[model samples]
Target: MEVDGNKFLNTGLLLVATILVAKLISAFIVPKSRKRLPPVVNGWPLIGGLPRFLKGPIFMLREEYPKLGSVFTVKLFHKNITFFIGPEVSAHFFKASESDLSQQEVYQFNVPTFGPGVVFDVDYSIRQEQFRFFTEALRVNKLKGYVNQMVVETEDYFSKWGSSGEVDLKYELEHLIILTASRCLLGREVRDKLFDDVSALFHDLDNGMLPISVLFPYLPIPAHKRRDKARQRLAEIFANIIASRKSANKSEDDMLQCFIDSKYKDGRPTTEAEVTGLLIAALFAGQHTSSITSTWTGAYLLCNKQYLSAVQEEQKNLMEKHGERVDHDILAEMDVLYRCIKEALRLHPPLIMLLRSSHSDFNVTTREGKEYDIPKGHIVATSPAFANRLPHIFKDPDRYDPDRFAVGREEDKVAGAFSYISFGGGRHGCLGEPFAYLQIKAIWTHLLRNFELELVSPFPEIDWNAMVVGVKGKVMVRYKRKELCVKQ
Candidate 1:
């Protein structure tokens, strides 16, 4: 009887010891402050909930946010990732300076693609200046010239496909934008001489930017090797172009010219290497974003027949007033088309989530007066993908309704703040927004006036595995030359 009692006592003691050890480990992780820390569910002894979080961060976050409230910490192996949600939380997060929350730490994968001494690889001041060059190139007056290039390139692309044909816009739009971007941004030398080679190199760069690269950038993988090789090759090509421009003592009003004339704070002309890096950065920013947004816009508009009819009606009015000639001012008058694009962007933003690595201990107080501390070196995150779908911010969030953005409705403004962050908010917001809208508007307008398009299949499943999530597999569309079809 004494032996049985001793055995039960030992088991009870072991259980108590395990609980104390866990509490000790938790205490060791962070200080016990008066203010509460974000809720972190009990996970594995050493690794925590990393494996579960990594499986589907988007799905996991969505599930946890409701249970844990607006602010919570997700323990990833040894790292603590603090996710801030709600309108108030988003405003503070987006407006926070780079000093407090660094983007470079989370986006280190950009080092190989953008090369050294540029973008995420360099200081914020340097990157800020570099982005300014891009903004200058895409300025209002400069963009006026690009409209013609967009129209011309788009027209040329559709011209090759007879009176009727099926096009996988996944491939078709990618090629079209490459041509348009090359013509308008990369300059005449790229458009006329090095188009195919540059396209192939960019493909290699694209292949390297896989979702796995985000977490494991330095893996000894085939794609990473190809990505490095492609980066070197593109640098060589851009370097030669810059040299040739200087040797010829000539100039053109394009993005390349902006890079050539771009002067540093030190009064020295920008180097070929820096110019190359800047060009790659601009391309990286616009490449998938524009392509994916365009893809989504087409997929959604086609699926929603009533909206498609509305777009066609607007296009008819546009052509009546302006005739066949297209320009920036004329494209701006496309209110219906504009709202459609806006809705598409809201529903399917290119970057689902944005990350920041907290540099100092940051305190977050919710609107409800709940306080939490975000420890230094922890990752801070916000998701435009999820935010755009918030019921309070967007009415009937899942429904494809552009009328919500109409003058009287203006649902986006109802939230009165960073509610609609499809283009992001604050300083690091997408600089290419105007350019992207202009390009998309130009392409769609041209297609509307020229071709009769029909969706061949239902909307594609979102391919979350892609670095920038896009419609999975082929997005096929059938189009007939409108004028020819009318005559027939």
Candidate 2:
């Protein structure tokens, strides 16, 4: 019996060794593929191009695009990514269906931050229904109400400027947007009573949304642990709020109620866990984009005097027509300011790159009639950073000229579809675009009408460390109340 047992053990060990050797040999064997593929950006073995990609993905993409054409493959660690650059490729990317491309797979790393059973963590149909709640919450009628709150918050928050000395626009806008979003979306209980603690927790949560987290979400690290804790604490906080609301049988007209009242196709009520995840996702979507865009817009306007004068003139005209009463309609007429914001977004978009994981074999045809076959299980990335810089799409592509979007020179549309993708394009385009414009327009109109600001610091470079690219350090502006200054 002992001899038989030893023979069986030795046989099993030999079989495992044979399989391991076969797998190791296969790891280095490159598959022969049909159809043309863009050249893979080369790097050292095993790690491949991960170090370069981590250093500055935009820089690496730009360098590769010029050399490898619009479609190219690059390896990052064990992952193979095919980048589709320029507008034509962008059209194909944005229009691809869920079967061919899976956003959930690409963004599953966000599950920890967004909590469970919501958005990218769920099945596709469920996610669609979940996103419907967001759409309903952002509809015109709801926005009509949200705009009032937005204006009120903007006026109340800006009332404390006190003819400001030098203020860091980045720091101030981050706080301002969080307060406004919390008051409007998360319910008054959270905004009024739990603001500080919630905001602090949100900070820790935001810190955990880095690129490294996207790669290894479950790695035992301090920030990842803090992120998990913050997510749980936020869930507890929202659960308490929901319990109290149900106990009182009270309903409030805000996103929290909308989420609570939302249902699946089968009529199942949304869970409290889902509600908390929705709020975190909503804030996550709008917070960084709004805050960063506001800072960039402020910095750009301050640095360009001609555009500043033009926007200020438009604001003065609005004031002459509407006085201190700022509303949605008045905000709409500030077209010059709108163009300036649009231009700033083109230059420094909040989310620099959008990624999708390919689920099946797909073909991409370039303008030259060349077809590249993308294989299954490869990650695909589309960068606004590169798309916006396509020379033929925008004349003097690198210059900051807002007029490029004006009148006969509507450059965003000049190069065909997906040319200007600051807000993204196609089925997955931004739903909060109107709200973003309204909030930003309200704040800037008020600032332009109330204060004169000067750029007190040199234009800061991009802080590549942030998940969203933000201006480095302080973009300081020296300010004095316009009402206090005598007319020239």
Candidate 3:
């Protein structure tokens, strides 16, 4: 043994070298191999981030975004909401199949509002079919007819404005949007005869979506009680209309008729309940969003004189070419006006956040190349309001610049598909996008053509209090009828 000391020393040195190599390998590889959850926002005991979230979800997201980076989570009571903040980290969020990221669970709150057996109440397959119905209802041909109705509604509504007067623009747009939506989507009966009653009921329905309602939709509260009543009454009203249409052997070119005429892939015609529910869903989706966007567009244009002049000039050129004819094609030609409205939506998207319940685990790599695993059962969310304002995505993101979307810049397309999600993108993108654009354009084009508008009130601030964020106070506007008239 003593004679073999050199061999023994060499063996000891080799063993030490192996030990050091193993340590180094583990130090480098083990951390890389472990599961990485998104950064979690630490909050109060048990209740977690609920209070801050309930106070201001967007503000909370904004505050946490800088600290947590693009992917992060905030616990609200028993729920863990993981946010995918930007386009780079959100492709799967927008594109995932229902089996991977299901919307039904996250949107169960809409059940009480949209009623049973339609939309959130139905399974994924049925929901897809229903969405198809919406898509068909808002097709280009259908939207052409809707554009005519929108123009008529806008003219009729604004014709009452005195030659020069001060008015609340927000109020005016809200009133007009409902009338147009009613005429186009709810049928002429609701528009001509029952506008006030139906609009009031919709008000009740809108008020029912209090923040707490998301968690306790069926709670025994006054708002919920009124909401249930409104739902029932709406069903009855629509049922009568459907019956009358069927019995009279009459049809109309509107979303109501479209829904009545719709059929599932299996060839099952929609029921009265289904029609009513779908109509309600359609109105709910468009009415407030259109109004909010319309107000923002006007507000932005009035505030930004250069953009306002650009849009007005576009209208002037359109009138010179079309001679006061404002059909779908003419409206389509008003690209300047379209960009203005789109920019407004980019700044103040009505639906601030979109959500999905993660049904299975998924990995997302962010723009910066950071990867994070979003676990099953987590509530996955993305914010259009936040993402649209990312400095990297849009130059001077906070400033109102419609030209950013103009041909040469096309900032929205610069970051690729989901860069501008004012109407969302991918699987659950808004089917009513064409309708929305046409509707807003119809209204704004009329205003620019027929009236000179000025923002009379201090520019309204974002009413963060609203479920659909919109102008906080009255957007008082002073308007005068234009003396120059182009033949219609």
Cα RMSD (Å) per model? 5.2, 4.0, 9.9
Candidate 3: tens digits of C-alpha lDDT, residues 150-227: 988888888888889999999999999999999999999999899899999999999999988988999999999999
Residue 363 displacement in candidate 3 (angstroms): 0.8
lDDT of 2 at 80: 91
**Worst 10-residue stretch by lDDT in candidate 1?**
479-488
Which lDDT value does model 1 have at 75? 79
Best by lDDT: 3
Compute each candidate's TM-score over C-alphas. Answer: 0.92, 0.92, 0.92
Model 3, which residues run further than 4 Å from truth?
A: 1-33, 486-488
lDDT of 1 at 71: 86
Better of 1 and 2 by lDDT: 2
Model 3, residue pairs in steric clash: none
List model 1 lDDT by residue over 1-488, tens digit each.
99999999999999999999989987997567665678985568778877766676678777887788778888777788888876867666788899998888899988888888888888899888887888888899989998888888888777788878898988888888888888888888999899999989988988998777878887879999999999999899988888888999989867889988988777878888888888887887887888888888898888989998999999878777777778889888989999999999998898888889889887888767888877888898888888888787788999999999999999888877788888888877888899999999988887777788888977788887777877799999998887732110
lDDT of 3 at 351: 94
On residues 176-219, what C-alpha lDDT tens digit does candidate 2 reach at each position? 88988897789889888999999989999998876778879988
